[model samples]
Target: MPTSLNDWLRILENRMLYLSSEAAEQVRLSAKEGKCEGLPLRVAALVQEDGSFHYAIGFEDTPKDEDVRFSDKGVDLIVAPASAGNTGRSMYPFEEIDPATLASWLEKGESVRLIDVRSPAEYAQGIIEGGELMPLHLIPLQMPEAKEGEKLVIYCRTGMRSGQACGFLSQQGKDGALNLRGGIVAWAQQGLPISRADKDVSVG
Candidate 1:
């Protein structure tokens, strides 16, 4: 076990895991919003049979016996043993923008890459207007090279998969990427417009 934050970071470095500043801020904000301030943020990842990865982020009040605990940029983090061993090259912060804010940006004609990180079937079922299809698992392979001043907004059926996509993009140094909070579910709940096949429907 590590003795202090420094020791923990050193261990993570050796294992090819890292924490980003933005991710640390998200951890802090998540805890505050959950009314569980001071709790550590837990991160776990696993590789699927097809080589894609799945990740989870949540808050924990206490560390488990098998957890690797550490703090960086004032954010406490816990890495599950299984995930720690299976982690990929790196991990980055998960940032999000509310549905209404995203809609407003589009309405204002702001330059943003509205990406639907869902399966083709799901995308065909319904998607935000102007959202391009880019499945979650294919993000790392399909995302274009990061460029300054470019904004990438990713969404899924719910916010879960898009959060993973944001993390993956952040790992590649795509700091401008943001996940659509609540995903299309929230957007539809807000009565926003979505495209179903070739038809445009207003949930509102």
Candidate 2:
């Protein structure tokens, strides 16, 4: 006698393969009670370009030009379509800048805005004194229109949030919003001076 439908489903799951509930049921019902046929299931296995398994899922048909995955021992990730190619627009590689560069730009009285995207409490701890406060959560609503060709610099506590803010600004027609690489932490870590809010506890 063949295994039951439930048993086959369990086997597929145990193997880390995927199957929709409906599809699994169809295979179960079509198989003989005691015996079973290996149903021809279509699947797209997203394997690394090198040769490691990233993820696999059963599909009805083959997809066109799947994303390439790296197979080397280095960090591997599923590169999204928007950031796949070498010259893709979504690829905004970070450009390292020192505190002196920032100070020089400010000294020259350049028409630039330092936008901060950290939380209120984090911002109060220590931030660029003249930087504009625009928390990440309010970027959608509080964002003001950017003038054409305006220069803007965005920063957050550790550079992560500010980078996201820069991306958001980029989408909002602010192409000049450069994210402060390494953020305030990088600035202070380099022995640069900092400014703190007088009422620190009020920020939270």
Candidate 3:
């Protein structure tokens, strides 16, 4: 298992103790499989009128814990920290950007270093034009080498990795590292062009 996933499973296992026996077992299996990457592990429990208990696990909404219903619709959707340095990780103000505002900034000749924090493989598959490839796994090693004065606009497929990268950068005192609110998927989905050319050419 990758160390990162194994570490997540360990923390999730401890949280599973709060769940019913069946749910805990399901989580154990899911953790070992690496099937639900980038998604939350949701468990739902239902009690039949005959007092028998039933459980389901995955990303489904269901009832749990003595008649309480579990669902993300009304919840704040805050993802729990998965890594060890979460306490010290700095967070980007991602929720602050609006689409129009972000577009306006992009229109201006901003000196921000637009970053794509996906893996090298993902970057090769596709990426937003002008984005600097800085995979999330490499953030710790690269942060110290980053120049301080430039604004770092980070992004990833759906913004998760970018948010994490921003946090890592903030921990390294690069407070200017702001994540693209929606990432390249959002950018491309909105009809923006993506470039396949070797961007590292310029950085080198």
Could you give me the TM-score of model 2 versus the true structure? 0.51
| Candidate 1 residue runs with Cα over 4 Å from true position | 1-91, 145-148, 198-204
Give the better candidate number (1 or 2) by TM-score: 1
Per-model TM-score versus the true fold:
0.55, 0.51, 0.50
- Alpha-carbon runs more than 4 Å astray in model 2: 1-98, 145-150, 198-204
Tens digits of per-residue lDDT for model 2 on 3-116?
A: 233433343344323333433443343233313333232322222345322211121122235443331222222222222123223323322244667867877887667777
Model 1 clash tally, residue pairs = 1
Candidate 3 Cα outliers beyond 4 Å, as residue runs: 1-102, 144-149, 199-204
Q: What is the lDDT of candidate 3?
A: 0.49
- In model 2, what is the error at residue 122, expressed in angstroms? 0.6
- Cα lDDT computed for each candidate against the true fold: 0.66, 0.50, 0.49
Better of 1 and 3 by TM-score: 1
Clashes of 2: 5
lDDT of 1 by residue, 1-204 (tens): 232345444655565345555455645654565577967767664544554334545565556576677776787777764332433333355557788889899888877878787777778798898887777656778874335655788888767667867876767666667778778988999999987654432211
Cα lDDT tens digits for candidate 3, 1-204: 012444434434444224334333434443345454334444222333553322222332232332223223222112233322211112222212323445666678655567677777778877666767766666777672336555557777665456556645655566556656556766777776778948453321
What is the lDDT, from 0 to 100, of the residue 150 in candidate 1? 54
State in Å the error of residue 37, model 3: 12
